[model samples]
Structure formats: structure tokens, C-alpha cells
Target: MTKEKFKSLMQEAGIKSKKELAELMGLHYGTINNWGNTQGYPTYLNNYFHFIIKAKKYDEALKKGFDESEKPQECPSNVEALSLENARLREECEKYEALKRALKEALR
Candidate 1:
């Protein structure tokens, strides 16, 4: 989701900030903001909201709980997408390292 839309969702759900949402999914602060901007989140956090919804027994139940002076929540899909993106970024870094090693070997 776009940052604006994500921010809107938080507002509609009565959430305060990305930090709270990230904490709900056991993520670092700014994780949700990054996900909203980049369309990716952590895999472990993917099913976080699903669990919360199931535990609460309604789509908005968790939100309601949060609205009632509790904290925010994280959704599974967002977390999964972000995890994939993070893995992809890690792989890219590995490739860069390999290329650097190869270049050093050639120069030597």
C-alpha cells in the first residue's frame, strides 16, 4: 500500500504511528513506514494480524481494541511482502560482495 493509504488505514483504525504497528508485529520502528512506502514487510510478521483477528474474532476487533486505548497491529500480507523484499535485498548485497571479491582477485 502507498504511504498515504497506509497512513489513512492507521487513522481509520485509530492507530497512532508506525512504531506501534511495528511493535504489534515484533518489528523495528519504521518498518511499517518502509512497508507502506516500498510495498514489502517481514515474513514472520505476515500472519501477525491474521492471528490477532482470529484471536479477537473479527476483522476490526483488533482495531477496536487498539482504538480503545490499546496499541496498533500488523497484517500478515504486509509482513510477508516486506520479508520477501528484505530477502531480495540481502541477496543483492551478496551478489555485490561476490562481484567485489572477483574484482579483487582479478586485480591481484
Candidate 2:
């Protein structure tokens, strides 16, 4: 990725500076600086940043609970279907959290 796009992604992911990102990724600050000055970031960085952003959204969603306005109107008429959908959503959330943890461990 280009340095500018990398910086934008970092900002979107709530990473304030290149040094902070370096710390999170277990890399030297100069290594990150070099990417901006000379070599560009690896292509995988795009996916990594996107994952971080999505993970942050997941965290917020879990904390606030699902938005009622986002729920389907017809769910109220079908209690069984609603229960089944809730269970499936919970399972999917668990899987996402597990994958996020695994990725963090691997990065370290």
C-alpha cells in the first residue's frame, strides 16, 4: 500500500501514529518510518488494518448491544425464528472474537 493510504487506514483504525502501530505490531519505529520514506508497506497490511477496524466495530457492538432500529420488523411476529437468528448471530460473534484473538497472538 502507498504510505498515504497506510496512514489513512491507521487513522481509521484509531491508531494515532506510526510509532503506536509499530509497538502493536512488535516492530521498531524506524522500520515503520522506512516504509514511508523508501519502501512501501506490504500488501497484507491492507487486510490487517481492515481487520483491526472491523474488530473495533465488533467490540462496540458487543458493548452497546444490537441496535433495535436495525432489527427486522417481522422478527416480532416469529418468536422461534427470532430466537434461532439470535443464537446463530451469537455463534458468529464468538467465532469472530476467537479469530481476532488468534490473529493477535500470531502477530505477537
lDDT of 1 by residue, 34-75 (tens): 684566644644355445445555756756745834543445
Candidate 2, lDDT over the whole model: 0.87
Q: For residues 3-105, could you state the per-residue lDDT of candidate 2 as single tens digits? A: 6798799999999988999998899999888886888787788998999999999999875554556665555657888899999999999999999999999
Candidate 2 TM-score versus the reference: 0.59
**Against the hidden true structure, what lDDT does model 1 obtain?**
0.65
Q: RMSD for each model, in Å, please?
A: 20.2, 17.1
lDDT of each: 0.65, 0.87
Highest-scoring model, TM-score: 2
TM-score of each: 0.34, 0.59
Distance (Å) between predicted and true CA of 18, model 2? 0.7
Evaluate candidate 1 by giving its C-alpha RMSD to the native, one decimal.
Answer: 20.2
